[model samples]
Target: MRIMLIGRWGKTHALAKALAASRDVELYSLMDKKNTGIASLSAHYELGNIKDLSVIQKFVEKHRIDMLFVVPEMSLARGITDYFNEKGIPAVGPSEFCTKLEGDKGFVRNLMKENHIDHYPDFHVFSDKKEAVEFIRNYSRPFAVKPSGITEGDGVKVMGIQLINKQEAMDYVEQIFDRSIGGMASVIIEEKIEGEEYTIQLFCDGKTVVPMPVVRDYKLLEEGESGLNTPGMGSVSYPNHLLPSLSKNNFDESVVIMERILDVLKEKYGEKYNGFLSGQFMLTEQGIRVVEINVRPGDSEILNIIPILQTDFMDICRAMANEKLDEIKISFAEKSTVCIYAVPEGFPTPSGKVQIHIDRKRFEKPGIHLFQSCFEAGESLYEPSPRLFAVTGTGDSLEEAREKCLEGLSGIRGKNIFYRKDIGTRDLAERYMKKYDLPGV
Candidate 1:
């Protein structure tokens, strides 16, 4: 089978690695930017705008692509999946209309509220800056200010963390409106729910939904979870397919909520949701609260997931495209995984490009996987657009996995390179466990 992968980043590289593992699959990639890691794996590689339908159409016909596996949310939001499906080429992704679950936060919030889906935070969507500011002024508690559309995971600003006070939130809202952040001049202000956040990713083929291992992603730029939010810094998953402090009940509840949302997409909106569906949840004082839903797989999380997967990824992709997901039994290895991302010094804000060096042999050790995320500027040189690359380690326990991951990361050398030192650490997990009264600290 010939499959074309569309995306740009470490997640896309991870997908390419999984697909390349199967001898029955031939990989073709179309990336907006060049990723040497993905390029090396692809039988054919082309650099073009993933959102340009004409460019993609020409490439698809040129390569005689049989199937498309799109990863990035931006391409999905541009109707690339719908476009391919209309042309009778099987595409593994959600349609443009279905992408609003992640693209338009306001739409999903309202959908959950109107459907009476429990655990949704109180929120209001506003297009006018004055109205948003007024709402902030009148609100009694701290809230999160967000752009209505995709922000590459950097558009959100919380009251206590990013914004100082109500006035700062109002100012941020104005900036979002004025700058047209996330390509939309609208904003969503939701009551902040403070707790330990975790992500549940599932595969859907319209009618059937299958859950993957739960991942706890660290989004902060700095360690101790205190810094600006970038795409993702790193993530951790255990051998039992749960985080350190997360119980099986919590994992099951997250899956139920995601399935219900998929049901609503089909029954209420007449949209058949496909591909990967992710529910970002927070275990608040009240209970598990739905933070948001994403149409694509979580970065860094995907890196942690693909390594432990025991099932053939090509079979899963085919199942998704053919709507026969129920026919396949997906499974993962009984192992823990830790993924750490290396980024530029000043991430979430532009900084000078840093040259990176890596010793590929260091990743040759068992259970150590390296996926590049930066742009190649020269031989043995990389320029970080934001993230440089990721090193994932798998073992019987989180501690061993973390040690392996850090050992692999040691091979990566560069000036002005930054990464979180505490990712997948027992200390961090214990902090959450004590705070939430969860067992297994």
Candidate 2:
């Protein structure tokens, strides 16, 4: 099978390397907005930006591509997938109907509430600034305001009760509706849920859904998630901790929430939909409430899930193409893994030029994987850009894996480069305290 992976970033790099390693597979082409990694791979084809349907058509026809693996930010979803299906090219991503799940937050939240899925507190979607301000001023506590479409993580802003006065609240309403994507005004406000957050990733091929390990993602770009939220800064997960069967101990409460959400989507949208379903959930005492739904794999979390997957991910993609989900046997390792981002100072935004020196041999010492980001492929280590690389560690325990990641990061000598020191701290503490019957809150 010839596979074409979209987005030549970190995920594409890892996915391409993994898929190319398989004896039964051939990576035909890879397309990115920019030609960053093209020089590295001989067979790699740079299609520039896949913005228009005509461009996508040309690329597919030229390569005779069979499968498309979308790792892009997803605005290209509707165009890419629709073209593929029309041309009889198999695709693994959300359909036009399902892309709205991520494309429109207001729509999905209403669907969740109507279907009895535990989401954030009750809220209203108001197009008018005055109406939204009136509601926000009368609300009891702080709430989260977001731009409905892709602002990356920068779209979400958590405002306190008194922080947003009449004037500031008025400004927020304008900002929410500032940008629009896919023709809908980009903005929604919701009462914030107070609890721990986790991302539940599932691979679905219309009928069957295969869940990955429980990945606890860290949002903050700096230590303790204090600064702005960039694309994920880091993540960690225990493959052994994820239960195969529905049980109180091993089975996650969030799993039930995700299953219910999928059920509702499938029932209404039809059984032909196929893609990766990711739910950003706030795990509270009340239940698991969804924060957002994504159409593709979560960034840093993908690094963790791939290592534990005993079955080839390509097989799952093939089954999805054939609509034979049950034929794919999915299993994971009984180990833990952590993927940490090595960021530059003033991140979640740009700071300035920074020098990064890395010793690959030191990081690859034992039980560790390095995924380079904002970098170039070469033998001599160099800082092509600010954000040097992402260092991942795997082991039997969280402590073992985290230590290896931290030790690996320390080896990188860089100027004005900084990363969150506590990527997996809260979750590890939460897991340990739960074992002792203590408070993880």
Global lDDT of each candidate: 0.89, 0.66
Error of 1 at 393 (Å): 0.7
Residue pairs with backbone overlap in model 2: 148-187
- The residue-by-residue lDDT of candidate 1 on 1-441, one tens digit each, is 889999878989999999999769999999988899999999999999988889989999999999999999999999999999999999999999999998889889888888878878888999888999898999997789989999877788998898888878888998999998988879999998888899988889999999999999999888888878788999999999987668889889889888888888899989999899888999888888998888998888889999999999999999998889999999999999999998877786776657677888998999999988887778767766578989999999999999999999999998878888899899888887787777775
- Estimate candidate 2's alpha-carbon lDDT, on a 0 to 1 scale: 0.66
What TM-score goes with each of the models? 0.98, 0.86
**Model 1 C-alpha lDDT versus the unseen true structure:** 0.89
What's the CA error at residue 21 for candidate 1, in Å?
0.5
Shift of residue 200 alpha carbon in model 2, Å: 1.1
Q: In order, what is each prediction's RMSD in angstroms?
A: 1.1, 3.9
Candidate 2 lDDT by residue in tens digits, 1-441? 777777655666666656665667657554543334422542656655655556666777788787887666553455577668667888777677777677777878788888877555766776665677777778776677766665544566666432345456557666565535333564576776665566778888877777787776776565645556567788888656542221334236666676776777778867345768887876555655678878777777787777667788788888876677798688888888878887766665655445556676885587677666564433433333334567777788777888888888887787766777676565555653464344434
Which ten-residue region of model 2 has the weakest summed lDDT? 242-251
Model 2: runs farther than 4 Å from truth?
Answer: 33-42, 160-170, 179-186, 242-253, 351-355, 363-366, 375-388, 425-441
Candidate 1 residue 422 Cα shift, in angstroms, is 0.9
